[model samples]
Target: MKKVLSMMMVLLLFVGMLAGCTSNTAPTETKEPEALKMGLVVSTLNNPFFVTLKDGAEAKAKEIGAELIVLDSQNDPAKELANVEDLVTKKVAAILINPTDSDAVGSAIKLANEAKIPVITLDRGANAGEVVTHIASDNVAGGKMAGKFIVDKLGGSGKAVELEGIAGTSAARDRGQGFNEAVNGTGIEVVAKQTADFDRTKGLSVMENILQAQPEINAVFAHNDEMALGALKAIEASGREIMVVGFDATDDAVKAVEEGKLAATVAQQPDKIGSLGVEMADKVLKGESVDSFVPVDLKLVTK
Candidate 1:
């Protein structure tokens, strides 16, 4: 009877050891991921095109398990510089910027460079700085496309008016250069060239004044969709049929083309520019080498 009791006690001890082992070997709960942060500074959120670009960057950040902090410059170069300084203060791992003015943004970019933060430019480029990459559509090529479209629509000869963007921006300069190059010997006379600052109200007002002066204008090319839509408003009010072409195919501009309101627009992939900027920032943060000039695709959109 004693021997039987001893064997039962040993069995109970074995059961206790097994229970302790199981408790120690249980699975652990998963921990949450670390939040990595990046910065994006855009020229303006007032335009739908830039809004779409911001949305694309946010989506890409979420996909890559990172957080994006965005700042709007409101199309002010001084404000853009302030925004970059603020981003540097936040100690962001990287920065992506769309400059309001290419040359004026140099100081802001210089600040980022001094901070050792990787910089990537989207849509517009800085005239001076050491940026890791510049991701944008070939604005020069897109401009040539717009010019060619206008020339073709006008049968290679017509009086045209050019509504320009902010004077010192790369977008404005490159687009103007391309357009001028394409129409040099095509018999398309640029009757008037004026800077509307890429604003709808300014574009409308400027075009209205131009219409009063040049009633024989047959084609209008604005540097951006906002200006194009504004020019359309003026053209409609004048009760004249003018072939209007623009750059940056925003959603409204594309719809306008489909409805035959505006003749055509050179479509730059703004969303792709934003997303690729983020991707390149990630690469730079990871010490990966990326192409200096990452060209996004451009296409001519016509009704």
Candidate 2:
């Protein structure tokens, strides 16, 4: 009986040990996910050029495993400012902006600055506020190239019309400056110059009006492909053989060039600009120093 009691006591001790082991075991702890967020504010989605820019930024964001929030400003300065505010409210890690109006975007950039969020300008730039970097092609040089092409094609003496972009934007200003600088001493007279606001429809209407006023234009220089294509349509309808030069070698513009509709275009890689902007933003967030201006290369595409 004593031996039986000893065995039972040993079994009870074993059971107690098992219970203590079970009770002392700790539950596995779960970790929270790391935060990664990016914001993209486009000036306008109506234009195919800006759409391509957005696509590049999206592709880069996906590759880097970050969440990208895209907002279309619809070419409105107020809307752009509002969108920047919304992104700030969302506490995004960084922001990439293609401003509708370079000067008007200052207020929005200031807000981002106050919130301590880094801002990178793509394609377009802000006149005021701190930007981590500005990624774009040299528009002035591109415009000069286009001007030189026009001068060469027309043998340095011809009547030309200029289709300008949005008045307040840096692109329109810089491109016009370059074109003017090149054409000044070339004897290529600019008989008419007008703003089209960078819209295809506007470009069409504006070019139509310009055509009515100046019927004997030898060449046309449009600030962007949209305007160039519009001017082309007007020229086609009028049965005129005006040499047209455009910027932004968009896909449609490229096709137009291949078909001999557009004379030439200064091809700025919107995709590269977008991707580089995101890459720079990432580096800035990682405490890396980046250049104030990152210039993408440009090529003149012609038929």
Candidate 3:
């Protein structure tokens, strides 16, 4: 009877231990790892669009209690590579990058891949390397929207000039492709196209030059709002009644449209892109698989 009682008590203690309900110790739950670190590499913050993007990512990170390390490439590919290296050294769980140049960013993406870190490309894509996902608005559709706006407004016949974004970026390539396609069989002739490097100052100067070179300019399409506003200034100075269409309906661009100064602008949700990127990165850290491409919505904003 003594042996039997001793064995039963021992078995009860073992069961209590397994249940994690011993009298001396309450039930202990497994805590989530506190180090959910993420890294964001932005091409440049000089542009309002990218600045807004950074803000969105930061906000989301704060909401989710994740640590976000932001590095700006200043539109330099070498700097972009260095930034990725820095992130890798920090051993971040995931990386988000807005590439300055699609082809030039391949090396940086490869570095992250070697480190076994997942990468999410924002706004632009890499020409090479493995990326877990790419997030952005439908740039091609936005470009087509801008082009179609001009085509229909001009009654399908007009002369226009395109002010492109950074030459080697996916945004530039896709937008230009869609725009060109929209104008291809129509009477809308793209007499001259120029690169403004997506800079407002450069856009103003380039448009000034194009205005002089192209005698008949009925419309203009800039890849972004900064360039569009710049081109609008040039057109206003030249006193030419040219209809201007722009992408990235930023505050200034939307205001211009409302004031009847700018014809139209393609609106993209930059905030959504940034927030979604961070959410996806969090999911990746949590061992969740994300899709290869996540597209934000777009709209044509006009008066």
Candidate 4:
């Protein structure tokens, strides 16, 4: 009898232990790493506008308790690809790419998709392939607005120069195209069209060369505010009173307009673009459907 009781007690204890082991779940998956990781790949951090974009993105990321890794491509497509690869290796949850070249970034986007990472494009977009979302301004319309402003201000008959942004960029190409289309039949001739690479120094030098040829240049249509300011400097040095128009309405450009230096600017709300991009990324991570393209509004600012 004593042996039987002892054996029964042992069996009960063993059964209880087995039940506990079977009832417990795998420690709740260790809380799933607790934080989100994001990557931002920009064309260049050289301009103040891009810097503001970086700042806005960082602020939003921090607000949402996410880790944001930002990289600058310096307008090099090769470097931009490398940056995207590095971000993928880091296992970022999502990527926000402002590509240097729209077509050049298509492969990178495909690679990210293959890696199962979501990509949100900012400011500029990929030419082809799948992107989670593309958030930018209506650059074509902005260019048209600039063209109208130039035509009305110059009375549709003036010699203008076009300082283009980075070659192969959507912003540069679309804006140039729309502006040209707007002034196509009008007498506003684009006397000199050259690539300024969206840099102030390059803009100044290019404008200087153009000035050597056409001293009576009437207006300048820079793809961005930086080049417009640079061209303004050159015009001032040459003692020429030329109407300067620009895009991207950077703070400096706004100040210039306020001071009667610039005639007009196409204001693309970059900070809003950054914030909206982050919000969309969060929505995507939450398993929500987002728009394929988010069009931020643009304004024509003039003094």
Candidate 5:
């Protein structure tokens, strides 16, 4: 009888121990909150300005512990569409886009809107769809600065060439408009206005052609630095002394300015634009509202 009682007590103790072990959980087993997933669609990683923009966005994402998925459109509208659709499939919390073309990006923005994902514009804006905010510099103002510099330098009389960006891009349109407005009343005559598609190679070829056709060109204003540098090379090859003004004060462009090779370049804060876009997306994800248009500052860099 003593032995049986001892066995029963041991069984009861074992049962209690089992219950305690099953009910108690380790304090270290606490769950972590999921990271917010965001998407960034760049028009092209080819340009240094856009590359810096991407780096800024990535830095912000790392600082805030958010997941950022970056995609390159390669400056193709079709590729941009494909990129947006892929992001939508992933069901990201928000999408920030630097559109290849303002008009072409409308359909891509519509996809995100249909999926109930928040959309924000980084450097460029979309004309077709709804967006929570547009973060960029005042492109028109920058263009005006470039134009006025040329006018003032030439004492209101000079022959210049305008190298345009992608035709349908907002940056191109606004920059062209502002430049034209600035030169309207002045004696600065834009002898040649051509599209180089914002590419250095195209700029080189176009400028080479123009140099052959036009004998007397005083200045050249390119929408972006890549084209400006390209035109500069062509002019150098032909040994012509012409003032070249570029936009997007990229590192190379700034260097050119410092070396007295480039007259001046309108500087836009691309990194700030990128960082601001991510910050705005974060706000929207947290149920906060943002402005319809968020404009970054711009300045002119010259030697």
Candidate 6:
């Protein structure tokens, strides 16, 4: 009977030992918070317009010691896609993109979403996609502002040639839309409208062609400063009685306005847009809600 009691105690102790071993082997699941890694895919760093944006984003990212990876798209949708793909491979926590084309960028945005990375669009936006936030100016309003400036400069009646920016860009489309609405039913007629690809050389060539076709062109509405400058060259070469209007209030364009060469420009604060975009991204990453459309203020520069 004593031996039986000993065996029972031994079995109980073994069971207890097994239970302790099992308890020790069980893992305590712990989840670690991820570090913030940010990426920016810009249209082009070649232009001073996007350069200011880059500077603003970089400064803000460095302020908080967050990792920032910036890539230049050169206004190519294919390149933009490749850049975003590379960033995804790196497993960035968030992405900031200024899409080259609204529709073309949807797939890239979807890929990022599939990877569980939040994307914030800056300056320009994607068409219909899952984006955390879109920060930009009221481009339509800006276009209207430019149109009003043209009318005021011409005293409400003149023949104008619209030097459009690159195709498939929000800036080009909305600005053109607003300008058309402002001039709707007005005596000031748009004699010709053509794309200048937002480049000075292209603007010059396209303006020259338009001038040949419409020699009585009274004004040229260039979508950006570079194109405006190009249009100025064509006007000088053609010896046409013409005034030039431009957008994006770039330094050179502002100087032109100050010099009485170009009439006016709608100033867009790209730097401010970049800074604000970063702030919004940060807020969203912290599990906070942000505004869907963050509109940056635009100013008209005539002097």
Models, CA RMSD each: 3.2, 1.9, 5.9, 4.1, 2.0, 6.7
Give the local distance difference test score of model 4: 0.91
Q: What's model 3's overall lDDT?
A: 0.94
Q: Model 4, residue 190: displacement in angstroms?
A: 1.4
Least well predicted 10-residue stretch by lDDT in candidate 5: 22-31
**Compared with the true structure, what per-residue lDDT tens digits does model 1 show for residues 55-117?**
999989999988999999999889999999999999999999999999999999999999998
Against the reference, the lDDT scores of all candidates come to: 0.93, 0.93, 0.94, 0.91, 0.94, 0.87
- Model 1 lDDT vs. the true structure? 0.93
* lDDT string, candidate 6, 1-303, tens digits: 999999999999999999999999999999976557899999888677888888888888877767789999998989999999999999988899998888888988998999999999998788857998899989899989888888887889999889887787888898899989988878799999999888889999998888878858777788888899999988888776688888888888899899988888889988888887788888988899998899999999887
Clash pairs detected, candidate 5 = none
**lDDT per residue (tens digit) for residues 1-303 in model 2:** 999999999999999999999888967788978658999999999999999999999899889988899999999999999999999999999999999999999999999999999999998888999999999989999989999999989899999999999988989998999999999988899999999998888888998999899868999999999999988998899887888999999999999999998999999989888889889999999999999999999889988
lDDT of 3 by residue, 127-216 (tens): 999998999988888889999999999999989999999999999999998899898899999998999999999999999999999989
Candidate 5 ranges beyond 4 A from true positions: 1-22, 25-28
Instruction: After the best TM-score superposition of candidate 5, give how far the Cα of residue 102 lies from its true spot, in angstroms.
Output: 0.5
Instruction: Output the TM-score of candidate 2.
Output: 0.94
The TM-scores, one per candidate, come to 0.90, 0.94, 0.89, 0.88, 0.94, 0.87
RMSD of 5: 2.0
Deviation (Å) of 183 in candidate 6: 0.6
Candidate 1, superposed: residue stretches over 4 Å from native: 1-33
Clashing pairs in 3: none
State residue 143's C-alpha deviation in candidate 3, in Å.
1.0
